[model samples]
Target: MEDLAQMTLDLTDRRLLSELQRKGRIFNSDLAEKVNLSASACHRRVQRLEAEGYINEYVALLDARKMGVPATIFVEITLSTQADEVLEAFEKAVQRIPDVLECHLTAGAADYILKVVAEDTEDFARIHRQYLTRLPGVAKMQSSFALRTVFKTTALPV
Candidate 1:
């Protein structure tokens, strides 16, 4: 919601996003062929998407367990105060955690939601004790361990 949408893309942009989802590192020429556009045009559109912040930096999606991050935890954080300064400090602190994959400020019983990855239960406990509960203005931290990840995605419907 931060960036205003401009330069409305037609079906070509949708196709380009779809191709990127299928192969993030796909060559520009190959992507152009798939989307029925010239290589230069495809590159330009992709650049535009990047500049607009639609496409953040690309990363190699890794297997969590193989990478020694076997545990997935979602923590709901409740802050001690609702003041702007309090919330900003809490957000800034939590965003620095490497294990935290995603975070969202929410409208519900909890103030914030966090998705974290760790090697096991002990690792999560350490993160919770040392980071989550100790974060500035944090009043409560509740964690739910994932039994299984049935669905996960980086692609958005174009």
Candidate 2:
């Protein structure tokens, strides 16, 4: 295996990645034809791409509304201190919260930001009382409910 930093994506590889991003379950024969490569070559390239960490795990994108958890809440959390133990404890505890979709260590006013989902505003309040308030070292916390999602995507440009 070669160093990932040194590996460059050519046109064919880029095409393969782009195609895979849009249609992950695309058949190898169909993918090869789209990318203008032989089936064996395409298979090898896909394997190499995965091995090199160009491709991460594939997953099904679910509908939040259908799942009954459509409400989106963005939480800005300010810790009491920037101590390593406080940060570590908060990060570890936040990961255990199933309602929290994403937790990011951030810059600006807040030490951390959390993207959370719930059935509704009441549900969020329940989550806040049940989970958020109990998080270690939380000095100040602010939450904003999303009225609507103007744009959202999992795909990144290849």
- Per-candidate Cα lDDT values, in order, are 0.89, 0.96
Candidate 1, residues 107-129, lDDT tens digits: the string is 99999999999989999989887
Task: Give me the runs in candidate 2 sitting further than 4 Å from their true place.
Answer: 1-6
Stretches of candidate 1 exceeding 4 Å from the true structure: 1-4
Clashes of each: 0, 0
Task: List model 2 lDDT by residue over 1-158, tens digit each.
Answer: 56668579999999999999999999999999999999999999999999888998898989999999999999999999999999999999999999999999999999999999999999999999999999999999999999999999887897
Residue pairs in clash, model 2: none
Q: What TM-score against the true fold does each predicted structure earn?
A: 0.91, 0.95
In Å, residue 142's CA in model 1 sits off its true spot by 1.0
Best by lDDT: 2
State residue 118's C-alpha deviation in candidate 2, in Å: 0.3
Q: lDDT score of model 2?
A: 0.96
